[model samples]
Target: MQRGKKKIKEWKLKDEDTRRQFEVKVQQKNNRNRGGWKQLSENVLEAAKEVCGESTGHRRRRRETWWWNEAVQRSLQEKKRAYKRWQRTQNEEYKREYKEKTRQAKREVARAKRLALENWSEELNSSEKQKEMFRIAKQMKRESKDVMGAKYIKDERGVIKINTEEILGRYVTLKTC
Candidate 1:
């Protein structure tokens, strides 16, 4: 039994070593075909040549005039003048439209206020009798019986009274008056 276990352990070790060797060989083959760092360096060199004009078949040229100097001054001044003129015209048009709109709005609000006042005055005059009837109806509805069968009463002089059945419905008026 011990000899059989030793044989088994040796077989496992061989299998592991063979697998590792195969993996290493495959990696080496892939690296060779892909040209890893050498291909990257070649591409970088070609890009540098193109950007620096070494591959364009022409010598590098120098600028004759500086961009921010006298060559651009006249054009810049002309642009500034045109911009100022445009701004003035726009402001004038905006002011005119704003004033007209504000005037129209004011007129509309004043007209609405006048109409509201006229309607209110007409309603007050036309409903005078109706209002008086409603007021009297409301006052009568509010009267109630309380302790000792007493009922609240009011007179034209603004005096109030509480009359009870025990007093034979006789009322004693109190001044508020």
Candidate 2:
């Protein structure tokens, strides 16, 4: 279908004739299986594929966690191995090593993710296009759902007013209240 229009191309051959020819071709290909495939329409075929979540790519379902890269995966695998070794041996040395490795792996992953975020933030801050910064800010707002607002209360005059009094809470939490 072409853009800016809603026109379906007419089939050169009729649907019934096309299905009959397709059936004959299938029958010829598979001599043993006399019962050929059922008539397939474009709509039905697309619907089936949609329902089945069909994809040609072998890695179509690969986990798409961007922050979890090869380095993090390697570290995690190493940590797992260390944990297993410690579990099997029950040695103090192995246990200490495993704990150290686990901590290091966690720290490395955190540093990498933090660095990535900082790099992105820096790039957005330095970008000439204002739209990019706004977009990033919008995305951050969406991902960080922490509400920010001062608590409002009805005054003696029966008017809702923002409470400016000091509250026994963290700044972020106070604002949220």
Best by TM-score: 2
Error of 1 at 55 (Å): 77
Native-vs-model 1 lDDT?
A: 0.48
- Local lDDT at 31 for model 1: 58
Most lDDT-accurate candidate: 2
**In model 2, what are the clashing residue pairs, if there are any?**
none
Model 1, span 1-177: residue lDDT tens? 112211111222234554465446445555555667777555444433333223222234323321233324444454455556656787776555555555555555566557656654565665774686578678777765343653565554545644454233333333221
Which parts of model 1 have CA positions greater than 4 angstroms off? 1-90, 126-177
Tens digits of lDDT, candidate 2, 144-167: 997778476554455665555523
Would you list the C-alpha lDDT of every candidate in the order shown? Answer: 0.48, 0.61
- In candidate 2, position 34 carries an lDDT of 40
